[model samples]
Target: MKKDIILAGVGGQGILTIAAILGQAAIKRGWHLKQAEVHGMSQRGGDVQSHLRLSDQPIWSDLIPFGGADMILSVEPMEALRYLPYLGKEGWIIANRTPFENIAVYPDLEKIYGEITRQPNHVLIDADTIAKDVKANRAMNIVVLGAAIKHIGFSVEEISDAIRDIFNRKGEKVVEDNLRALQAGIEAK
Candidate 1:
């Protein structure tokens, strides 16, 4: 089986870190993986995206074709809409309900929320508040990942293991809090 996931956010939002953890988990699960990242002026909060492919077969490219993604994991609402065209009709979207201001005006959150809900497969999480509650607002990406894993065929324990491995040097409490955040996201909806 093959899965294509697109993760999007602005710079410093942990988009690449999220991709790395997912890739590591896929590796631990013994799946062939390929990942590509693009950061458009990421330093100033520009668009940052990662294309991740996990499959039982050998994968050649890290790029995800237009409308070829099975899942879209977005850390910000507007970024989720920006990558909407990449999701096929049957694709699932897991988005954080946070607003990332880029343009002079922010996008309409309620309208975007309504459109995403209409897709039937979309899952929205308040990752920002969740992360803040965990005292790691930066872990919002992991929160989004936790929500996204429900669509993918992975167990929560597997994801927790991956988180442990990824943040092994950050001390036990950090990993534990992240694990809790992940569980909170997974159990949401």
Candidate 2:
């Protein structure tokens, strides 16, 4: 089996962290994976995207072809819409319901969210709020990842282990908070 995923979010939202967590989990599962990142002036809060491909078999390319993605997993709502063209007909969109409005020309939230929910395969959650509730506001990315865990190819324990491994350097408190955030996201309605 294989999965083509588009990971998107604005700068400073820790999009690469998500890729790292997932990539680590992929490694634990013995899956062949390729990740291609588009920084897009990330430090300036411009669009940041990563294309991740995982397969049980050897993969050929790092790039996910147009309309070939199995899912667009985003940490920001608008960033999710920006990659809609990459999603195939049966593709799923798992995005945070929260908006990260750094620009003056940001579109209306209702319209964007309305469009997101209109899709049958979309899973929208307030990851930021969920993380905040767990007192780990910075772990919104993990919360978002947790919410989409059911959709991704990896099992929950694999990703959870990756999370512990990734945040262990920050000390036990950080790891505990992030784990709480992840659980909150998994149980999010």
* Model 2 TM: 0.95
> Which candidate should be chosen as best, given lDDT against the real structure?
2
Report how far off residue 187 is in candidate 2 (Å). 1.1
Candidate 2, residues 9-93: lDDT per residue as tens digits? 9878887888888888888889899999865455587888999998889999999999999999999998999999899889999
CA lDDT of every candidate: 0.84, 0.88
Supply every candidate's count of residue pairs whose N, Cα or C atoms clash at under 3 angstroms.
0, 0
Which stretches of candidate 1 lie above 4 Å from their native place?
39-43
Query: How many clashing residue pairs, candidate 2?
Result: 0
In model 1, which residue pairs have backbone atoms overlapping below 3 Å? none
- List the lowest-lDDT window of 10 residues for candidate 1: 37-46
TM-score of each: 0.93, 0.95
